[model samples]
Target: MLDQVHLPPLAQDFLAYLSLEKRYSPHTVQSYSLDLSQFFQYIQEQYGGIALDSVKAAHVQSWLALGLEGRKKAEDAHKRAQPPASAVTIRRKMSALKSFFKYALRKGAVKQSPMARVTGPKLPGRLPVFVDEHVMEKVETNQAGDDIPLFSDDFAGATRRMILRLLYHAGIRRAELTGLRDGSIDFSNGQMKVLGKGNKERIIPLGTAVLKELREYIAWRDAEFPGYAGGALLLTAHGKPVQAWDVYRTVRKALAQVTTLKKRSPHVLRHTFATHLMNNGADINAVKELLGHASLASTQVYTHNTIEKLRRVHEQAHPRG
Candidate 1:
């Protein structure tokens, strides 16, 4: 493992800029740091060592190739060769290099970035996986049954239901839902304020049923843990803040019984929300805003699922017999 002190100055500067100025989430910044550290370690091994700004496009390409080859094993003579990194992983590493070089150029640390000429490996397109509408409805309507462990009277049960409900109805990311405060929801207006990527805020309208459930959950939470005075909207039975994994586990447990879809996590609920909206004639732009997506391109992927739904409807309904 490369030590922090050993990282090149330019790389350090770029990471600092990402954290301090760009205000990227810690998770995102950590990913960039890991990607760059691996690249730099490859640099020390291959080229003895070179400044980040002085590195060329060929070096970046070589790094990608090495990443795919599993780090050129030197640990043991009889050690089994490791499998190559996936295309997605390689793409993210290259993206980090490209982003770092771009920042270096902007900061006048380098006159030109070698990544300007470097192109990432071609990645296979995968459609966003979502829960089927019938399955989702089943999960939503089915109360604290055998699959879902939590009962409404208990703290765990109420929180689990609230977690699933907000993710399905609001279509917000898990992080946004995790950071939600007591003030995030406006019961009167039936709207929710969500903090998305890069700390961007967006308002999501809530349905009447969702609003009613929110009110019930709040009342139950207060009565269950009266002394707690935290700002977080959701809390554990002990009145501690809810973490991301807590939400994930709750979502996973709730979804396991209903969804045969392999990726049964909270995010799939977001996809289901978007897919259902578009299938029911919601505008693409409107869904984009509700989803807190920065680009229309990101939102357009849901259209593929919608189009498939239309195709199935046409085949089933059109009978000229």
Candidate 2:
């Protein structure tokens, strides 16, 4: 199944744009490469290892069939063993193929986008589970005490707590937080440079509480690691840059202490941040821009939350028995 075959030229060009023109990092480039590679492998198997340029509509249809197979395999894995892929993983692979074909069509490398005419398998939306404002406030209250044992202690405990609050308060993604450096924070203007999807940059505003915690955390960090702090904001005990999983584990552990929400990942907190803002009367379009969602359709899930709340209010108040 691992034969060596060149990708369609369009995919190659896209990779060039991703790295040279867009300046995507190595990890991002590799992810796109894996996505495209998996797509082509599926296509090859569907078409009996046909030539790269020979693919047609039937091949695209077959790829969707392969997605179905992947899901079936997932179900069997649950009963007897571990699934090699989740629904989310399959969806992502499909998205990668869709983007690749679209790029090929746009560049005239392919006659048309195969994904345009082919229908992808529909997936149900699984809304994120996040703690309510009351519980989040409880977390804040619990973590508000001064640095124990010494004013300038390790600060790892306090710093990690601030990271959780920052993610919950601001709807930025985990990559945005992990990619952050000390210089990314423009404290005077109270904004942060957040690198989001596709390596795009945006400025995010911070609340007074997050800002205060960050300033104190920075001071504490400097005190502990004297002459060691360079730029990265969140760091290990040894002042090294924080990784993506580090932030995820911190959020998971913090949420476990104060909330019963099952999904406690950083992105869940980001989703909670948006829905809560909308419930509290923030503009929907404003949330779209802040979360760096390319389309408002992607940001419209919060509207569902609003609808549910209104339905409950109507049922409780406007009863006509």
Q: Write down the TM-score for model 2.
A: 0.60
Each prediction's number of clashing residue pairs: 0, 1
> Scored by CA lDDT, what does every candidate get?
0.84, 0.75
lDDT of 2 by residue, 1-321 (tens): 334363556677888888998898988777788878766766665555665446676776665565555445464555344324555666676676777777777776677666666665557776556568887776666642343221123477776776777787778788888888888888999988888888898889988778888899888888888887477888787678888888998888777776677788998888889988888998989999888999999988888887777888888888661
* Candidate 2, residue 168: how far the Cα is off, in Å: 1.2
Candidate 1 at 207: error in angstroms?
0.7
lDDT, residue 66, model 2: 58
What's the lDDT of the predicted structure labeled candidate 1? 0.84
Q: Tens digits of per-residue lDDT for model 1 on 286-314?
A: 99999999999999999999989888988
Q: Candidate 2, 162: how far from true, in Å?
A: 1.3
